[model samples]
Target: MLETLELLKISTREQDRVEREFNMGGAQSADKGHGYHVLRVQENSPAHLAGIEPFFDYIVGINGIPLDTPESRVLQDQLLANMDKEVVLAIYSTKEQELREVPMIPNRSWTSNPGDGLIGLSIRFCTYEATNEHVWHILNVAPESPAELAGLIPYTDYIIGTPHVTLHSENDFYEFIEAYTGHPLRLYVYNSDFDACREVVITPNHAWGGEGALGCGVGYGYLHRIPKTNKYHNSQLTYQGDLKQQPQQFNDQSLPVEKSHPSMTNTDVVTVIPTTITTAPLIIETPAEPPETNRPQQSQQYPNYHQTIHFNNDKVPLDP
Candidate 1:
């Protein structure tokens, strides 16, 4: 507490209003090839009542911020640990293509549930193209208020990207989220693109801002009832991504490397070995005067010139 307060005093940005959100990439996950870890489920959360489950990956962007490092994990954890926190979690489940968001503090307060603080349904992605290969199907319908009272199915795909549950159409984006009029919901995903899926629920804990609907949850994340591989972005969506490396130490790296090229090796071949048999390298140091030095450098391959001119006395008899 004292440490945080002391740091807050010296911080350039206001500590209280500093924007905080969900975590994504980290060394822990990266080294393990798991990427960043998110708050899948808190012990107690409002998301539980609405059928939101834990272990689902956070998929959406928060506070217009995108993170590619696990340091983001520390930052997110810090925010939740603070009092009266607000964040937006993009929830992804194995079930659907659409999205659901569990916001710490929405611009609009859309809830009136005494126990349930969220006035909106927490879901996965909400947008899609008919051209998409697969879709998440809503599965079960729990008997209760709102959506259950209305004629909706647990087998249909929840619209992507909003709290409102509306029919698919060729219209504006916001026009789609206008479906849910603020109610808790449970959706079963029918993923056409993916192979298999398991059913899970998300429950939002409002400990940080846990004043019911009046307060958002503490550790907010992308609340995907049905986790997905992609975001509701304008591009191809997939969980596969680049590695998140920790910031390299500048001075540490700025200094010269303690080693040389990996290809180069410390070998005795490179080193000049001292030998007592130097004998001038079996080489005549400086040639005497010109011609005296211009002797046959390399010996003839076959033999000396004398060998080719065989002048035998016996051969002379035949030449007569």
Candidate 2:
């Protein structure tokens, strides 16, 4: 009984250590409550020098005390009281998916501007929900444009974030791209089609015979969110034919004339059905005959669809 009691105590101590390391009791989860969400970190400042990241990183605790309270003044008062003293900040990084302790001494001398905070960090007290759902959906990529050259696929790709900085708003990506004009910028792109994430390097330039720097139409919000696996189905073509049947032999004179492309043929119908439990099967019938005049291929098959340039704007609204 004594040995069992000792084992239980050891397990409890290990659990407590894990909780403190990851700030498990703090605002790690949306249900847990709120924390100081780092909005911006000024260069050469105490927070910036201490590797405090913006947007993705949150100040969850200070000096072993969890800052999970909804009151912003609690954090402000604590920081003001601890100025010039070396304090350990419990920082939760959404990008790295880890919680770490950052030690720094907050001082007003870091910046000449009195308006700037002692740590030179602008943070907001908000609930932190660890999720990768926030992303910019790629709607269209202009042909011969920087986006196209960088191999950005429309309707399948999503800009999750950048490795250097976390993107919090819709304008964040555009502003980052504009800042890196003529310079290469790395992006974390997630594709629903492949159900995978990849790093893509793209250079934004206005000389690509396009309207926008990257010449890509990006969207955000619910409608633009990455489709759930069950709701989305990649178009697959299945050839129904007898394996025993020999290849069709055609004489030079009796050869069948090609009426239109195989895609427009009624015999080869591609039915894309949604795998969602609540949704019905979506039936898409192909046209029997092709158009008389040459028309552009469908957006799903090709990325040549016309898109209105919105990258020039300072702010792009999120999709409802």
Candidate 3:
């Protein structure tokens, strides 16, 4: 078994080529370098049964062997040769930021499709970056849409990830939103204008009379990365401090006003204050209230329309 697996090993030159092609920054430790990113894991398959999660997991090694090869055929060949035999896969979780070993026996009977691999997983060779730099840039959010209602700001906000799941690919965010359709999915969003991270809850639904579930256009890749400037860094800290103090100030003001009005019962006064304060941030940050004369003419053209917008040769459907 050991000799058969040795065939999967590539030359040192080939390994270097792999690193260069994927921009993995040369040789890295066994646990933190290049690996095959799991894009999809078929249900009831060996990979899924072994707790391999799609989009957030990477297959780094097979049978204690690090898969540093450029081509995915190396990993496929190893699995095919080790069929029916218990093989240990070195799995890396992007969410947990850890490496673990999962044992599974590959077989063709897992799925009805004849073309399905023994492991039943779709993966692509890529470099793994242990950073929260990746983000989905919000482009246009439809008026009265779920995204707008949830406080997502177009061209200003970026969806980083959720509390539990760390988004690895562009499709990860879309898939997550679909999974939580009709249910609230809390996301950690960063604003370019504020340079701050905050939690936003969005309930995605198809009944919102929009083309997409969230009614928002999100762009990924290098162009959408967060700006690396300290221009707003100092202000972000000051803004966060102000946010904490605002609630206390509102509470103090509301209590005295409630005492002044004895006719307006305690329950009515208490409910009004909480609702007003909770939505205060959204009201203040809303971009719709700006005068059209002050804004650009092109932005006003698609005020209530949803259409495709091309960006760098890629077609992105944007809602306004």
Candidate 4:
């Protein structure tokens, strides 16, 4: 217990040196420099399920003491070098505020706070593209998705739609991803060949975790697919004189040169379509009053800070 207290005292001093008040981002500073802070506590992360997020402004000291910063990197470094392997965090647990010392034993993956009652949400490594074909084979929007919720559907390739969806580039597919963050969109899709078409709205929800957070859809890689579309031909070709260009034929039928891409995707996506809530939904472009700019801070002193220490914990002193 004495040794643990000493470590805590040292860690607290380090945290104090780094954590500065008045940051631009939301809360999550306590376990700042320690390795534990990397495992974010978003409602979805394992840490969050373990009842982490217990307090805010984890700034225990300044330059080897407690404090936050005014949006600068120097101060950030000062706060991070003080952590090691014993800080614990979560939403709720036996110990309320302050971290409960945890040994730096690898694979100590046990949390008292049950866990995120498993679900079937599929996760994958992927990216999305924008193509006319993607928009051409149109259909209705998927309800409860970002697209549909945005009040737009993959209908008649609206080269122009509200919410101002734009093509970021012919190469970077994640271009429109920014459009989905904090905003939802509804989509309508279709495929002439399959004689299948439907509306399914999709939204991109991402969060970063482990001490500090990044965004949703963890364990993925650099996604780079162009967001493109294909030309929507109303009528299929009858006896074609030049359809030979399409070297590939299905069921002995000449096919069109397949040269179109798709849009916003949920990769390796494992999902269970929810029951279509009241068919008619509302889409607010600019509500009379926009939603709160930032979420509410749970704690008092210097709240509104979210976790973010993108380094491996090694700065703290070794116990003798």
Model 1 lDDT per residue over 201-296, tens place: 222122323222212111111332234444322221222221122211111001011122111121211110111122221111111111122223
TM-score for every candidate vs. truth?
Answer: 0.22, 0.42, 0.40, 0.19
Report the lDDT of model 3 for residue 222: 53
lDDT of each: 0.24, 0.49, 0.49, 0.22
Can you write out model 4's per-residue Cα lDDT over 1-320, one digit (the tens) per residue? 01122222334443333223111122431222211111112233222332222111121222222122222232123213323222221111101122221111111233222221111011111111111112221234444533334443342322111112322322211333332344444322333333222333344444322211112111111121112122211111111111111111112111111111111111111111111111211111111222333323332111111111111111111111
Best by TM-score: 2
Q: Can you give the lDDT of residue 12 in candidate 3? A: 56
Flag clash pairs in model 3.
none
Q: Whole-model lDDT for model 2 versus the true structure?
A: 0.49
lDDT of candidate 2 over 1-320, digit per residue (tens) = 01121211324453354454344335442223345665445567677677665545677656545555443233455566777887666566543445555667767787776545567665545555534346678987889988899999998997755544444544444555555567776665767766555667788788999777888887766577556442101111011111011122211111011222122111111111111112111222222321123222322111222211111101112111
Candidate 3 lDDT at 22 equals 31
After the best TM-score superposition of candidate 1, give how far the Cα of residue 309 lies from its true spot, in angstroms. 86
Which 10-residue window of candidate 3 scores lowest in summed lDDT?
A: 247-256
Query: What is the overall TM-score of model 3 with all chains considered together?
Result: 0.40
In candidate 2, the residue pairs with backbone N, CA or C atoms under 3 Å apart (3 or more residues apart, or in different chains) clash, namely none
